[model samples]
Target: MYRKMVLIRRFEEMAGKQYMQASIGGFCHLYIGQEAVAVGIISALRPDDYVMGTYREHGQILAVGSDPKAIMAELFGRETGISRGKGGSMHLFDRERNFMGGDGIVGGGLPIATGVGLAIRYRGGDQVCVCFFGDGAVNEGAFHEALNMAALWKLPVIFVCENNLYGMGTQVTRASAVPDLNRRVSGYGMESAHVDGMDLLAIRALSDDVVAECRAGRGPWFIEAKTYRYRGHSMADPATYRTKDEVEEWRVRDPISIYEKQLLGAGLITDEEIRGISAEIDAVVDESVKFAEESPFPQADALYDHVYASGE
Candidate 1:
C-alpha cells in the first residue's frame, strides 16, 4: 500500500511539473498529498467493480488500473487518450476496466454511480460501485438526489468523500453547514464514517469492511476520508486563502510518508523494497511523459468525429 501510494504521489508530482511546462494542456488538478485515500479505497475493490470520481482523479484512475501511458496521453490531449482526447483530465473513462469516468461537475458522478448500482441490482450482479468526490461536492443537488435514491433503494454504492479541508479556495466550514461531512450522510439514512485519510492502513481496513458489506447487499455506505492537498486548488490560484502554516501542518502528516513509516515499523515492507518501488514508479512516469510527447495530436477534420454516429 505504501509503494502504491508513493507511485500516485510521484505521478501527480510529475504531472504537475509537466503541466507547468505546458506539455500537458487543459484543466489539471494534482493529488499530491492525498494519495492514501484513492490507493486504499481502490485497492479494496475488485477489478470488475466500477469506480468514479471528480476532476482531481489521476490517482483514482491509476489506482483502479488504467494504463499510465494512456492517462498521460489524455492529459496531453492526444488521440491515443482513454477518452480519445475528448475528456482530458476530468473525464477519464475506461469501460473495459469498469472505471466509468472522472466527471467535471461537482457531485456529477454520484448520480451515475447510483445508476450503475441500480443496473447491478437489477441484473443481480454483485459488483459494487465506488464513487469518489471532494468535500465541496457534498452540497450539490446531484449529491443529495443520488444519495437519497441509493439509500432508498439500498444500492451497493460506496460514497468515498475525499475531504481535503477545502473545495478549491473555500474552506469546508464556509461551504458546508456541517463540518462533520460524514455524519451529514446519515440524514439520508446511510451508514457513514470519518477516517484518517493520511493513514493508508486505516483507510484500507475501513474500505475493505465497507466494500465487503456492500458486496453482501448491505449497502449505501458513505466514507469521509479527511485528507489534505499540498498544492493550491489549481495552477492559477496562489492559495492565499490558506496560510503556509496550514500547508506545512498537513505536509507533516503526509499520507505517503506516514504510511511508509507504519509499514516499515510493522515489518510489512522493507526500506529496500520501498526505494525499488519508487524507482519503478519514476521510470513508468518518465516513460509516460516521453510517450505523451511522441504521440500525435488529433487531426483537424477529426474534430466533428465521435460527436454523433453517422448512418454511413
Candidate 2:
C-alpha cells in the first residue's frame, strides 16, 4: 500500500519539476502530499469500476493502473497520449481502465460519475463509479445536483472529497459555511464518512466496507478525506496564500513517511525492499519521461479527430 503511495509522491514531485523546466505544458496539478487518499481509494476499486476525478488527478489515474508513459505523453500533448493529445493534462480518458477522465472544471466529474452510476444500475451491472473532487467543489451547484440524483435513484457511486484545505487560494473554511463535509452530505440523506487522509491502512480498511456497501446496491456514499497539498494549486502558483508553519504542520503527517514507518516497524517490509521499490519506480518514471520526449506531437489535421463528434 505504501509502495503505491510512494510511487505517486515521486511521480508528482518529478512532474512539478518538469513543469518548471517546460517538459510538461498546460495545467499541471500535483498530488504531492495526498498520496494516501488516492492509493487507499483506488486500491479498493475493481478493474471494471469507473473513476471520475478533477484536475488534480495524476495520482488517481496512475493508481488505477494507467500507463505512466501514456499519462506523461498526454501531459506533453503528444499524438501518443492517452487522449491522443486532444485533451492535454486536464483531460486523460481511458475506457479500458474505466477511468472516465480528469475534468478541468472543479465540480464537473461529479455529474459525470452520477450518470455513470445510473447507467450501471440501469444496465444491471455490479460496477460502481468513484468520483473525486476538491473541497472547493463542494460549493458548486453540480455537487448538490448530482448528489440529489444519486441519492434519489440509489446509484452506486462513491463521492470522494479530497479536502486539501485550499481551493486555489481560498481556504475551505472561508468558502464553505458548514466546513464539516461529511455532515454536508447528510442533508441529501446519503451515507458519509470522514477518514484521516494521511492514514493509508485506515483509508483502505474504510474503503473496503464502503465499496462493499455500494456494490451491494446501497445507493451512494460520500467520503471526506482530510489532507494537505505540498504544492500550490498549479505550477504557476506561488502559494503565498498559506503560511510556511501550516504547510510544515501538515508535512509532519506526510502520508508516505507515516505509512513507510508502519510497514517497516510491523515487519511487513524491510528497508531493503523499500529502497528497491523506490529505485524501480524512479526508473519507470524516467522511462515515461523518455517516451514522452520521443513521442510526436499531434498533427494539425488530426486536431478535430477526438474533440468533435463525427455525427454532430
Assess every candidate by TM-score. Answer: 0.97, 0.97
Kindly list the per-residue Cα lDDT of model 2 for residues 1-312, writing each as its tens digit.
776787788788878878989988888989998999988999998899999978888999889988989988998889999999888888988889989889999899899899999999999998889999999999999999999999999999999999999999999889999999878899999999999999998999999999999999996999999999999999989899999999999999999889989988899999899999999999988898899999999998795565556733
Best by TM-score: 2
Clashing pairs in 2: none
Give the C-alpha miss distance for residue 289 in model 2, angstroms: 0.6
Q: What are the C-alpha RMSDs, in order, of all predicted structures?
A: 1.3, 1.2
Q: After superposition, how far is residue 21 of candidate 1 from its true place, in Å?
A: 1.0
Look at candidate 2 and tell me the lDDT of residue 234: 91
Candidate 1, 1-312: lDDT as tens digits: 665677788778888889899988777888888888999999998888999878998988888878889999999899888888888988889888898888889889999999999999999989999999998999999999999999999999999999998999999989988888756787899999889999988999999999999999999899999999898887667789999999999999988888778878989889888888989989998998888889899888778787777723
Candidate 1, superposed: residue stretches over 4 Å from native: 309-312
